[model samples]
Target: MFVGHYAAAFALKGREKEASLGWLFIATQFVDILFFPFVVWGLETMEFVPGYTETNDFKMEFPFTHSLIGSILWAIAFGGIFFLLFGRKKTSGKSIAFVLGLGVLSHWVADLFVHTPDLPLLHGEPKFGFGLWHNKAATFALEALVLLLGLWYYLKRTVAKNKFGKFVSIGFVLFLLLVNYLNYYVLPANHDIIGLTISALVSYFLFAGLAFWVDTKRT
Candidate 1:
């Protein structure tokens, strides 16, 4: 889902009026930030279980960060910190922070479509998802479309406020998105723990870099 998740924040770009680019970026990926640490701590888990479906091949055992309630709780916790730190100086700070939390929660919502039945409704009740990725080409197409459309909308609604800024942000997004497809669908296979850790770490790195670059270009 990579860049497609940006829709969570992009939904409010110009609408929010004065939201910071960093928080929006943070919102979409806040779960992953929690996810990686939780993964390392063995509090959550994944397996490259081949043939979990026809094409999709990953199984997740994530409760601390991926559960519906856990995600909302994490969103509030992160956004609250954002509010306290930034809202004291400006009212829009809290608004932006609040919206960004919803952005964080949006990840799980979006995942529900493409993921396997690994995503739980609550902490334990029967896990569920539509398994959209089983149709590889369609899954990729939808993911790419969301990223491009959201990013295009983001660029159109806001000026770069600096020379070549929009181009730079677009450039980074393009590169990172390509990298994900390459690493995920094209790269050499590594069906092991090292492989899993590397993938998660790279995902974080790619998104964090894109966020940092976009933050700098914000109007």
Candidate 2:
């Protein structure tokens, strides 16, 4: 559910051209961004277990951040903050806020596809997932297909502002694919939760920054 989450961002930005792609990127991963820090703070937790799933080795116990209710609450909070910060100034404020909230909720929905029934309906209620991660090839193909389709829609909705925009946009897509590949096959599993948390936070912010740059380079 890594780069697959960004498909929501791309589709969101394409639908609402006024929404910030950077923020949308953050929104799509907002719960995950919270999940890692929650892990470090002992509010939530996960562990590296070999063969936990076909795609990765992490066994998560993130009720506060990955729960269905928690996700909805976070989305509402995110939308509220956006409304107070910048959405209030625009005529399309409500629409933008809604889209941002949708982006936040999209993370949980995407995770539902690949996760191993770890996502809770509430703090202590039942958990559910489709367990797509159990199949490596299917996971990879599904992520790539969703990302490509979203990117295609985005490109159709917006045009490049210059040569740099055109080239960099393509490069960014390749970079995302490369990262996904590395995550699945190249990167070694780190058992240290703190280190994993730091890495996850860094990667999320870096991708958000890149998405911001890409947005600026386009119309």
Candidate 3:
């Protein structure tokens, strides 16, 4: 659900080409952006428990950020604010609103595929997920395929403006895959939840920044 979330951001740019991919990247991960901070504040919680799932170690208790209702509410707020601030200038506010809202909701959809049934539908239990994370190889393949397909679509829809664009666009995907590998295979076990939360937050912004840079280099 990490880099795979970026697939939504990349695919979205093909349609919302006028919208900033940096912003779209942020939008797709908007929930986790909130989740990390909430974890830091103790408003949400997670614990690193090894062997809980093949790819996920943390048992999460995050309702305010991970719930479907919460996500929709956040999406509405973000889309409303985004449209008022930026969408009004260049495009139809209605379309931008929907796209932005959907961008936010896409996080939940992607998480549904990889996470255990910990994602809540509303306030509490009745959570659901396909739990692809139970199988490491399958999870990796799913994330890689989504990310690669997104990159392919993006490359097809927009031609590189310079050599840097060509190089960085490809590099960006490699970098994300590298990070994914490290997270799944190389990161130290039994890491503190606080440090992990901070790292996750930092990674989100780092990827978003890369998206901004790549967007500027391309169309």
Q: Give the winner by TM-score.
A: 2
- Model 2 vs truth, CA RMSD: 1.1
Candidate 3 segments whose C-alpha is farther than 4 A from its true place:
none
After TM-score superposition, the amount by which residue 181's alpha carbon in candidate 1 deviates from its true location, in angstroms, is: 2.1
Q: For model 3, what is the alpha-carbon lDDT of residue 16?
A: 68
Q: Score each candidate by Cα lDDT.
A: 0.73, 0.90, 0.86
Candidate 3 lDDT by residue in tens digits, 106-145: 9999999999999998868899889999998899889999
Pairs of residues at least 3 apart in sequence or in different chains that clash in candidate 2: none
Question: Model 3 scores what on Cα lDDT?
Answer: 0.86
Provide the global lDDT of candidate 2 against the true structure: 0.90
lDDT of 1 by residue, 8-51 (tens): 56655655757765567667877876776677678888677777
Query: What TM-score number comes out for model 3?
Result: 0.94
- Please report the candidate that would top lDDT against the real structure: 2
Model 2: worst 10 consecutive residues (lDDT sum)? 165-174
lDDT of 3 at 44: 89
